[model samples]
Target: MSSTNRRDFLRASAAAALSAAVPADLFAQSETAQSSPGAIWDSGSVRHLLPTVSDSRMLIKVSFTAPVEGEPRLHVGDLTVRGSMGDTRGEHWHFYATDLGPGRRYPLSLVGSNGRALCQPWELATFPGPDERPNRFRLLIYTCGGGHEVHKFLPTAVRNRLLRRGLSFQPDAMIANGDHVYWDLLAPVGSRLLGAAPEAVKAAGTFDRSAIVLGSDNETVLKRAAGPQIVPVYGTDFRSTPVFFLQDDHDYFDNDEATDEVVTFPPSYFMLQLARATQGIYYPEFLPDSARPLGLPWSSGRDRAWGVSESFGTLRFGRLAEILLYDVRRTQTMAGPSAVYIDPAVEKWLKARTAATEVAHVVHVPSNPPGWTAGKWGEWYPDVLGREGKLTTNEPKPYWQPGWLKQHDRLIEAMAAVKGRAPLVISGDLHAIAIGRMLRSGRLDLKDNPVNVVLSGPLGSRPGPLGWPSGRRGTGAMPSAHLDMEEQVKPIEQHGFTVADFTREKIVLRLFKWDIKTQPVEAIDTLQPFHTAELTRPA
Candidate 1:
């Protein structure tokens, strides 16, 4: 054959062979994997691995490089958001895939409108489907983002330890029970008052919201390590593993007082606004009016007085389990203790979800402890006090009036009424790990209606009291006396996180403690069953 003809013949033969060797679907994926400059993903700019709603459908979040020039596109299996150029860029954008069942990993690829590949397409996780009874499941629980108790900032080493351990533990979900950010004291003043006398600690701010709320510079007093530092530690890579967030007193400005621009040390309007903005930005949430005319952000709305709203609702992963996340921070007000601590709508929501029959268990997440503590248990948050002429100081002094005490009484009544499932109560704020059976006010047999209280937290660090590296426990009033319960006012000396595993027969809790004296302790010492517990449906 002629030279030109022979070459053409050989090229055609090679092309045909290549096509025959590769699968059509594989070839198509490779073709689309190529990106154009108009659409790119900046992975380093990617943060916040949030699993919003995981069920038959999965809603995942992704953040892009600042000045995100174009819309971000997501591609996974048959799911794609090609024309869905969402309004948010350089910020957060959520997209979902329907018909996705639970308990499996789905491979995904994300690209910004600019064509930057966010991360080499990876597998995103999904919870177990309702019909399937997965033999086991797991979750990690944590609180207190302060690094070294004394350091009180994004302790990089500490965050690394948490990240490493969480990855190693392989929890199906992670619940940041409360106090993810300690914005109680803003900037300069906060630095000076890290662990000042209880009376002097406050939520004072400089009003330049950007500096402390989102900045990772630990030097700033309100440097919310949860944002710049801790979020990165978790990263968008864990998008498959759902992460849930809850707010406590610290997250709401000071320790517990929710505010509308008050004169007290805790609830400054600007600080609340900052917390609202920051909370909405960092976490994945089901906002106030999700079905409004357009997409509304979490914690804010044109309809609200201060553009702030609620973050309490129910999350279910099939019929296996359901969670009720309560908004204790926003529900509070300077309106005296007799006022409502939970929005009526939220309370209604909680009561209804607790009655769901499909789930094997119901978990209640209230930022503050439900059981009573001794004199001045939750003083920092300002829940039981009012801002009227009757009380002058914001400190947790003898400021609690009858009205405040009455409000707490209301909480007790509400807790007493919660039934249907043997409930699991997980709380933070005490800065220690403590667990005991909760007996309702008039019940003696905890076996039938026992309220198991599990305390988990201090992921970063926080000093307990004077001259002590850990917090000294304060005794509190028991919820009920008729039942077998421990009225624990014991001091908690350890600092760490809890990893919980759920099996068909029982749910197990493994408490991992760290050395408060060290930033990132080389080893994670497992505490005994005292910090752990196992439970099954009451017989």
Candidate 2:
């Protein structure tokens, strides 16, 4: 109880406090992380995916701030699947548990290397196998996001209404067809600039916009945003459903403005590297063998100033449907009809799948609709020329430029070759909700086939479709061969998702829409789709 004893106690307390402090390091390695364990990745980085395949399998992955010092295994039901943190994204650890049994639901949690419960478990749902014919299933497609921290960057009520819809019509699986999150800013808030529209920041893929939501150089920031800001929007459904995400221009660069030159792409060198590393941290690709596979993202040789990835591939589901996921941003032609949107490999794969006699349908998931949407930025439409390569405009440099039109026809021809199943093109971009039948007879027609093109997008943005009162956002749509016999049904330009119900016989599509400006969450609780249409196999 003497003054000397009190002094000794104070010294010990001070030493412990110093050792336990967590340093505010962004991406720093540390021996004294107990006080402030530098993040290898942020807490709770769980991502779910249903690998493209006819069979059932689910993939669950988590990114850790640092590699687990010991072992990391995921426990689902009575089965234990070992996970490895050997993968790194700028010192951050990526742990994956893939190819787990499909068709059953299970609660998943982490069992640490040291034999302790590392984190809470989540419920996962896998798909059915190839030989299986899933008469029908609903899939939620999300795309064209506002950005990482929607709260900070804009006042828009960023919401994903389809995710919140309960068990009644909740989707069986989900597809994030790119425009997932925006990360164009290179500096902190104080040193950055922004644009009027989210796209404006790229200033239409020409300007440098700055805003700090996460770190271009730090995995922790991106993980934190994905955990709290991004993940939950899918809500409890994410606990049980599978999600597949593909990258677009935004996921790669700020936004891609398809000028006449592929060599002049804005994001090159370190900027591309930052984008690639950040992307690697968030959406690591996991392709199952059962899903028809193809080569992955690759470099355009020197153009890859950012990252190298193979974002195009295919998945065939039994004899029911085939899913074709292509990277429009990277593969897009440097200029015009012959530019080569389908890398010869991708086209070959598409043609082979189309030729397959078994599959009844093809679900084509492209980043943007094959062409432009009259509802939003119609002039930016690329396929202005008709099937015969006849120009519609007489201007020297018209409002829109030429693009992969020839290749576009090739894509549809391949689709027509898809023996039994009518190709269903589901896409994202142009913050409008429009389901249309392509006008093949028009001068601007896509082709002679009945390929139906649908839009599912703006999971985060303005709540209404582009032209609301009429709700015919897509009636007089761009004439792409893909949507030849098209009719605009309930073209309500609003924030929403499209659910396509598929069976061996037909695929009926329903557009589920929402309004944050009015009902907020109340808008999504509906048994009926805002609009619905049916498509049967061609006779």
Candidate 3:
């Protein structure tokens, strides 16, 4: 079947499942509540939430203030607050009042346990109506961050400053390509090595001092660790503003494995659960059931794992472009002939979507093949490199290995076949920023194959001084022994997120590196003007 058909089938299936999950009465209640002016809410302990999208019918996922110990009750009628989605479960509520309507300010009054009403500082204004014209959207991209140490936030601050300047130039959306959170590293020390040990040795090691300390106090360590707090803060700052999130190796499990295989690392699951719980992701609703198989097929061994596969489908914003959200992590291969490969179904879907679109822009969310050669930063097991010297055996794996230019060539072919359109590939993963144009071989019949590939990463993590593995460096800001791109493209060393502004006539990709010293540290480097690109329609 074609990709579009498959996607339609999947959506239909999910909608059916969702309909089944919510009974008639609950659905009617939600519908009624939505029609009425929602109650206003105050922001207190509610930190952050996830899957930020603007579809009115979309099932919103959120997280709010956890209840105090032994006092799990909150009386909503007492406090004065603003900008709330609404109350669902008793005492527990999710707010989505941002940008609701003109002149109508919605705020909620909350009654605390003390019988006093406190007002929340923030209010949710209704969102602006969709733009009728082709609207320009910017995406802030980053990936492969190891942890959220204070230093990590430094780069993000710098990038934010740059974005502030960039935003002045153009409006845009933020896309966190993957590795949004580095939860795997927060696992207690020595936990990653658990499976490598023999059963007897593992049992004995489990009782060791370090293991006992970590296992006993894993939650405490994770809460205090660099990632938990940092991710929420970073997410809160950006997610509320504008963004789309994709999961990478770090978000799912360290080095990219199914959830079941990495069960020994309790903190990984804990952090993910916390992220979901706090964000109001409605895990049971959005995620697929482990007991059943649907959407993308998985190995029998990989079934029954705690993971969710979601296809954002396609977004056509007026006449500007079509944005396709592809989940590459779910279909990854750990022990197969290759390390990374797009599922055949997904590949077909992508091809059909691109082929069907004549819109001025197309955005894909996956790390470009060329960026993988930067070497693993103490993340995944090193033994997985196949005999082909490539990470994966997928058709695109061989020519696309490391520093080879053929990866770009194959990518160009794929784009050219997409109804002969020139596509701008937006990606993250390598903890660095890159921008380049890929020109297809004349043999491919693509006159405009030289489309740009824009990448930004390390939003919270710091950029390393040099490329990895010394001799096999691919492409990065650092001068390396492996690949040299001085003639073709030069990488700049600014550690922050990236924002891409797309219009009908052109696509401008701007890199925003944050400046940490400023009080509201999310300032941009004034020196770097917007990096603009004017793309002509393909003939």
Per candidate, the number of residue pairs that clash is 34, 45, 45
Deviation from native of the Cα of residue 31 in model 1, angstroms: 45
Give a tens-digit lDDT track for model 3, residues 38-104: 1132233444433333322112233445532222222212332222222232223332222223212
Worst 10 residues of 2 by lDDT: 13-22
For model 1, how does the per-residue alpha-carbon lDDT over 1-539 read when each residue is reduced to its tens digit?
A: 58565434322311110111222132123212321211222244565546554555555555445535566777755678542222223455656566665555666666667665554454555665666656556777777653323344435555655555554444567777666665445423333454232432332224353554433332233332335434654555355556777766666545432234323333466556555655545565542222121222234455222222345644555566666666565654445545455655555556555655666666777776654332232432222222442222344443333443444334434443455555677776656566676664332334446666766756655433521222222232233222245634243545667776665555776665665666334444222223556677645
- The model with the greatest lDDT is 1
Candidate 2: residue 294 Cα off by (Å): 4.3
Stronger candidate by lDDT (2 vs 3): 2
Candidates 1 and 2: which is better by lDDT? 1
In candidate 1, stretches whose alpha carbon ends up further than 4 angstroms from where it belongs are 1-48, 63-66, 82-104, 129-133, 146-154, 185-205, 208-226, 257-269, 287-310, 334-337, 372-420, 440-448, 463-484, 487-491, 518-520, 525-530
Task: Give a tens-digit lDDT track for model 2, residues 412-461.
Answer: 66775554566677877555577765545234443545667777745664
TM-score of every model?
Answer: 0.69, 0.70, 0.58
lDDT of each: 0.50, 0.49, 0.39
What's model 1's TM-score? 0.69
